[model samples]
Target: MKNRVEILAPAGSYEVFLAVMNAGADAVYLAGNMFGARAYAGNLNNEELIKAIEYCKFHNKKMYLTVNTLLKNNEINNELYDYLLPLYNSGLDGVIVQDYGVMKFIHESFPDMEIHASTQMTITDSGYADFLRKYNVTRIVPARELGLEEIRDIHDRTGMEIECFVHGALCYCYSGLCLMSSFIGGRSGNRGRCAQTCRLDFNYNGRESKILSLKDLCTLDILPEIIEAGVFSLKIEGRMKSAEYAAGVTSIYRKYVDMYLNKGKETYKVDKKDRNRLLMLFDRGGQTDGYYMRHNGREMIADNTKISKDLGEKKQYEEYIHRTFVEANPKIKINGIVTIKKNNPVTMSLSFGNIAITIDGPTCETALNRAVSREDVDKQLRKMGQTMFELDTLDIRMEDNIFIPLKSLNELRRTAVDRLTDAYLEASKRNNSHRFLPCAAHKESRNKGISVHVLTYEQADEAVKHNIQRMVIDTEVMSGDEISRCVELCRKNNVKSYIGLPRVDRGTYNVKSNSDGYMIRNMSQKTKCDKEVIADYCIYAFNNYAVSALEDYGITGITYPLELNEKELSEMDIDNGELVVYGRIPLMITANCIDKTSGNCHKGSTLFSMLRDRKNALLPVLTCCKFCYNIIYNSVPVYLFDKLDRIRIQPEYYGIIFTTENATEVADVFKCFNNRTKPEDNTFTRGHFTRGVE
Candidate 1:
């Protein structure tokens, strides 16, 4: 039979790491002191990481470091290598990465290292997975929303190892695409500080509820289907959880995974008591199967059961888990031989697996009182104490009149054990120097192409009058017939057409328009497109390599990230980069509607509503009742109209997003950009285009 599936667990802290290992995890993922998505977690420093790597290797378990957040240009150029070198040298099993720039840097600098595409990449189809294979990415933690059929399709086509989240907290918005945290306050989730505004109270009409709060995902019952679909690793989400949570959850999943692999599928079942424990660990209302079945369903949302309080006496076992894990024997047992002579130094030779270590004790002294006995040698050598090694066999030879001090023997035992530990660790190092074939270069059309992303036809009409080459419209805004008319009108004028898909694509948009392409928010939407796919800015293509990778995945054009400044963007040398010259930044996207929270669940309302944060900045909320999600745009538009002259050099196209702007306001925005007029303060913003996030 094939090897059983991996039971992957989260390690928030060192205690959690030990607990998870003790509970039986094949692998555990933890963030280090830098570039981790779980910034608030007690991420290990370089020293702690060394210990972690050694611990995993000693136990024959895989340890993947999380370098999963988006990094700015300065951070990439200045700090990435320094942060990674020691870990790489220490034999880190793999690195989970989100930023394309970071991945490219690691791939180029450390070719032998195993790279995993983070779930933040939102990989949805085989086309994208196969494309990422160029970077030698060994595995992909696909978006949490992908279904069984989609996962199987990706596996059959790409053959890249797929890791799916079997159990954990769920994000209401698609990961990476969410900017709600960034714009609302300045805490960017991509940088690992999500305020979790989604968990806040939002209402539908008169009823107040935690609409954006999603139930935790528990897929125990669906393990067989998941395994059959070719998921190489079953991941558990919750790096911000407790040690007891880690031990309990991991143990439960470990048991099921083993039972299913050992017995038949017919005998597989989730114990009732275990299920309740899982619920108590953490869940909203209760657990859902996640989007494994489908997307945009009411069953996935939670209106109550906000906090998961306690686990009765089971919580007390957390101490036991930590104590047991730290005390477990090394997976690789060592055998040793000791020799003592009258004058020469006593010699000890230790062997572990195929490797051997030898150390000499202090010069043997003649014991005038008592010669070193066989029992004395045995006692000293076998005193392994708290070390990770266990002396499977200890053989000693002493010459007549030999006198070796017990202290010298103990010192020899410690030295031999230390040397053997290093020898054991050396086996983990690999020379995975992967070779990459050169990719051909390409160019973008530097046509000063001004494509207006409009949510309304009034803005569309104004955009057509301007030098707009393309008019990207939200398909949710108009009916199929009306959108077709708008597409026809844009064609009647000289503009090309593209439909703007939502960040988390739940269903195919009913766009009967004769469109030229799609401006896709995430990779999952790429599968539904028949024409050109424009990788949206939310895809976070900050580096040339990332843009190239997306292009290889069938994306024809790209929108560079808003997080990059003008200097950073210009250096990227993107083949078909679309600079966001203008638009209000979308602060956050949520499944919770503010209008509903404000006691106005006006489902049919297209009117713009606003949510005032503590700072009194009005955040515009657009209800997408059809998709069961909402778009929360920032209070002010990012006006680079003043920098059009400075931005004239790079990117094939310069685009503007038109949200909530009337026909009059649209013309003013175009005029401002066309003539390089600097819009006044309080009316416009220069979001992150000048100052990047840390």
Candidate 2:
């Protein structure tokens, strides 16, 4: 069972969920309406989600909810937590998280909640996987663009479970990081409602229209190769597909996986019969193996209609029957008067406005009902039965004038089957079942403190009152008296403080081993006595240099963003240092409001349209900070809280960060972290002074 290759499928709805599961999906991945990457699909609503979870557990299958959408500073709200808590508490196996902010919040809410880093994180290296392990992430879904070798390397180096996309659609940009949909359509893909604008044909002057539409990824041929590579799960990427499509895809993959495992990998092939069956279900253009085979991007597009096939001939009577039904009068019925005879034999009296006749016979019952005028009666008779008694008869026997419509009785039978199938299908997936541990609400931490850019006294006072234990003061405003005052105030309020200093002498800011605490800034600006001044204020900082060198200089903590490339961070020996677990990735450096020179409005705010091979994002100036400009594009928020296991960070040296404006949102993030931490552990601790050797 441990070596079993899991066939993961997409469950856009309960029906699709069941079809894929019954059709042979080992697991099903779905999303709630919010924060899911596939926004446009018929994704499960909350009530449906509850049923889906029950259904998965009943089938002994794993269900991974896709919380893998990028978040803005404003979108992280109390309502988000309201939805998250119940799911986590309900013995939900795992959450597929994309953004760091969501990861931070989930980690802070359910510290023990199993998290899988979504491919959206674009983690492409073993180092990245190793780095993510610190957050206790169960799996790392590597970027879709990775080769089989790359996936294996990551698997070998880091023992964390690795999931890879086996089949379905492929993205032109890197998975989980593409901004093309949001940039063009204002429909953010990270939110699960992506407008697939890439498939459209466009023209770039003089050239015949260029079809940027990509071929769907069908890796049936390489099933064994991927499984042999030690991939934990073989995921199919189609959250917004029809039930039939999900069934077809899942069935094909299931058959192939069985073939590869039971038979041999050489036995598997994508032949004409299977291809036709797949295309008959549905397709965008056609299918391809995609980047699973290493190649330049040129072959991404292939022959579009090569997959089409002739549908062959229909039955001779099919057309006539279909046309007759299509054009028939639907609102016609015949009424008859009823009578009964001796020996329990049923008789009918027909009186249609002064025309009366007596029909009495057990065998005559069939003939009498058919004598009433309706051309479509034969069709109804064929479906229901040969005789009136067999037609679910309701005997309204009377000596006088009561009229009963035979068509009306026939209509009842027809409606019953429709309702029965509809009801059964709906009822099939629901479960009021209970588990060993039902999900419950856990209180998240509310630790908000100083990340003030200006580092003013007013902001510092607010922090002191709010039990904000940490302050990171800028080196530009570094004063011994101000630092001492802040340190004493922190002590009085039972808070810890750190003065920020530039990394110069040994890539760290020096703090005295005596009073308060210190943070090391990685910014490349240092004066002659920058380290000297920091030491005078009892400040120590961790930066991009040797940890041993910083240890000698009494550097207390390291300040690094969650945006560190995993390979780059793995090369360093940061045995005991703090890392930024959560924050928005400031991915660009721009001249201040260069595009918004016109004072009237930011009407013509231009962004990076296209840069080299990478697509450009509209870097709108979301906010104006005193020193640095906070520009927001459709840039994804980063969450490393779930990746604590891969990163191997000492809890004391790990921290989650939010800008002053968005600090409150991290309340749930810290709450989840604090609840999971040991009573004596300071890993849930934050701020400049908390990163001391413990």
Relative to the true structure, how large is the alpha-carbon lDDT of every model? 0.77, 0.51
Q: Report the number of the highest-TM-score candidate.
A: 1
Q: Give the root-mean-square deviation of each candidate in angstroms.
A: 4.2, 18.5
Q: Give per-residue CA lDDT, model 1, range 210-242, as digits (tens).
A: 656788899999998899999989999889888
Q: Which ten contiguous residues of candidate 1 have the minimum total lDDT? A: 432-441
Q: Per-residue lDDT of 1-694 in model 2, one digit per residue for the tens? A: 1267789999888777877876788898998877787777778788878766655544567888888875533244435566766665554678998765465556556676679988876665664443345457879898776778878887887887889998788765555544445444545455565677555544322222223456778777777888888797999888777766776778778887887777676666756666656656555567767666763244456446665544442222223323333222222122343343223333443322223344443321333333432333334433534211122332354322222355643554444433332333342332332222212222132323333221344445544544344555533333456666666776787765556543121212344422344453321122222332222111112122223333334444434422224443443344444455543333322222222322222332322221111233222233222222223333333345455554533333444333332234334445544454322222232211222110
Candidate 2 residue spans exceeding 4 A from truth: 73-75, 269-271, 305-694
What lDDT score is found at residue 86 in candidate 2? 63
